[model samples]
Target: MRRVLAGLVAGALLALAGCTAESPKTDDGAAAPTGPPCLPAASAAASPGPAPSSAGKPLPAMAVRCFDGGRYVDVAQLGNAPTILNLWRSNCEPCRTELPAFQRFVTSAGSKVRVVGVIVMDSRPAAQSVIDDKQLTFPMLEDRDQQFSIALSQVVGRSVASALPATLFIAPGGRIVYTYQGIALDDEKIRALTAAHLGIEVAA
Candidate 1:
């Protein structure tokens, strides 16, 4: 009986050892059954897809309507004044942040350039709130139809089609001289650019 019991115990110990040995190894070579799959470091650094504006071309002409005193005004009749057309949306954070600066530029350099706001992809009420909150003195054009955006995109470059917060610097002759997109325009930059383009000194 003693011999039989001893043999049985020995067999049990061997079986347990075999089961433990079959477990997955841990980092320290200890037994661990569950872990995430490891990936090669080089594969993690692979490049992503193409960037915005990778098409390498300008946008097509887009016609837009202007909002003037609850009436729709034609874009072509926007007058002969040197104009700064600012394309903005109500929900865009950059647009909201840069609006005050644009307002200041309009206030200080009103005589030099006419700053017009084009509301793109935004409702009238939402845009009105921005105008009221920021106290924007310039006319805010209603571009809910995206016509102006399409038109201006053609003038700048095709890459501008997918970009927002674009500004077109239209000369007195109705030609676009400067175009900026995806950036907040501050007072100093606006004043300098406008003064240079309009050929007049912007009063401090």
Candidate 2:
């Protein structure tokens, strides 16, 4: 409980005073991490949203380097499942605080959704340190050029005044459902957002 609150506070700080990460080291040609940790079994048949429109906009097709495995993968390949693309930095306090919660969410999510981390505008060492300290096992990617966030702003139609710590919820078939640009540390809140936006119910 205390840990969760700490994360929330740290996330809030990061949201306001964020730091950028550097380009990750990907020259080793390492294999991509096998996959994400198991997600929670929070399945409920989707109630289905209003009138299936043909207007489900797709995420950008940029290629990002996997931070852990040192390989390049297309962003398009990541949205096959209900997905959450969290943009965080190593230097951000909230990111450090919120990562554990996200990791837990991913573990609880099992195969229900894909949660990918994007570390941008921060150095790789700092990012890795936080990941190690937090024991985060989620898949991560690098965004050294800082263009991804801008692209996200355009797609989601939200002014990413401060892009770090942003969470983009992409529904199945690659359409973005919502973009949360702040700290979200509460397990119940995260679960509720997952259930409401992605149609995957995560056990609280």
The model with the greatest TM-score is 2
Model 2 clashing-pair count: 18
lDDT by residue (tens digit), candidate 2, 45-116: 322333322334678877776666555676766555677888888777877778888988978877777778
Which residue pairs overlap in candidate 1's backbone? 57-158, 58-157, 58-158, 59-154, 59-158, 62-150, 62-151
User: For candidate 2, what is the TM-score?
Assistant: 0.72
Q: Candidate 1 overall Cα lDDT vs. reference?
A: 0.62
- Model 1 poorest ten-residue lDDT run: 33-42
Give per-residue CA lDDT, model 1, range 1-204, as digits (tens). 999999999999999999888855433354431211211222222222112212222333333444433334545433245667788887888888888998888678745567777788786567767877887766666666666666666566554435667777666435566677757878788787777655546776
RMSD of each: 23.5, 16.5
Off by over 4 Å in 1: 1-63, 68-70, 159-161
lDDT of 2 at 172: 63
Query: Model 2, residue 51: what's the lDDT?
Result: 32
| Model 2 segments more than 4 A misplaced | 1-25, 28-56, 159-161
